[model samples]
Target: MAEGALFEFLCRMGDNTLVLGHRVSEWCGHAPVLEEDIALANTALDLIGQTQMWLGLAGEVEGKGRSADDLAMLRDAWDFRNVLLAEQPNGDFGQTMMRQFLFDAWHVEMLAALTRSSDARIAAIAAKAVKEAAYHVERSGDTVIGLGDGTTESHRRMQAALDLLWPYVGEMFLPDAVDAAMAEAGVAPDPASLRPAFDARIGAVMAAATLTIPEDDFAHKGGKSGFRHSEHLGHMLTEMQWLQRAYPGASW
Candidate 1:
């Protein structure tokens, strides 16, 4: 049971990275500037690479016949364990930056905590990923601050992106049964414990960006716990899973 739960937990992490990576990769040819385009694409590659590592580990933990590709490409939208924040549509450059910033902030905190995980594999993966996630957080945070403080129009767009993406941010810190079990088992970090660090990092970035944090009177939650996601997830899964669905066992 512990191993099964661990596999599920790892898959959830991988799925979030995979889906968000796919969304960000869509901007490669469409970014507003060449440098920004290259950066976004590189970031997407890093995230997808991380996903592959996590998913492969998950497959091993599961002790099942499923390969990493099978777990990623064969899963339907309902079966995916990714958060809604990852599936939310990338509205504009500002929106994309905001989305990435939010996730990167959470990831940095999470990975830092996971470095202490009792599970050697989890700790090792986190140790390696923390460096990358730290850079991701810094880059995205810088982008947020630049756009938010750049000009009237840029500020407005950045503010709007923050407002739109804020609701989904809550899910990152909301702990679930799996999280509780993992925390108890020492296989994963308790997300709740990471909240303070996440908040400090996010608050500093928002302040530097000259952006106000959104009010949380009604925080939207329920993603990793397996609730349905935003409408965009279905479309994303269609594109991502189509080849595997259409041609079972097909590969280069």
Candidate 2:
């Protein structure tokens, strides 16, 4: 892959975690249960920590002076490259679990494949991330199964969550030109190649949960190209970047 393309790819990877971590962090002290509150907080920390590693390496690759903090706390929402799913709002508990399960499954596959990346830096990061991703998947999957198979109200909510989230899942596997180049160069895994496995894993979780995937074929796109985003991102960034943006260059 071209150096610039690779840098962009890394940025997308980092941005996904950064945004999703922020979303999960919103659950801190507000989850439906204390156990889940702590669980989501820890999950958020893992994702944010991954964001630091990925963005720090992106800076190294771009040969820019920017640090992970700069990328995480400075960039505007329009510049972010996370998949639409990652930036999507956390709805009810079921929706949040569904979103986490979907991303966790895909992330595990992506990171596992990335551990074999020709780029040593990428491989090292993926090696560590895969473990965390696996745990995320297990936790999310179990929660989904429990909720879906629980009360009638929970079953309804879980089913609705699955439907709402299904379309966004497509974006995770849509490969662009940059992705092609990186895959060819062994610096990145082919996103499309991860689709079948993603589908299988997701299907298994859904089956255990007794939830049905949505029938809608339409899917949102363009977060990676920065051409499309939900309005939620601006609000999210306003809060996430407040300290850094309000006091530029302020440090502890």
Please, what is the whole-model Cα lDDT of each candidate in the order they appear?
0.88, 0.91
Clashing pairs in 1: none
Model 2, 1-252: lDDT tens per residue?
478998889999999999999999999988999989999999999999999999999888888798999888888878898998998899988899989999999999999999999999999999999999999999999999999988999999999888888888888899989899899999888899999898898788788888887767687898877788888888999999999888998899
lDDT of 1 by residue, 34-61 (tens): 9999999999998898898899899888
lDDT of 2 at 231: 85
Top-TM-score candidate index: 2
**Ten-residue region with minimum lDDT total, candidate 2:** 210-219
Clash counts per candidate, in order, are 0, 0
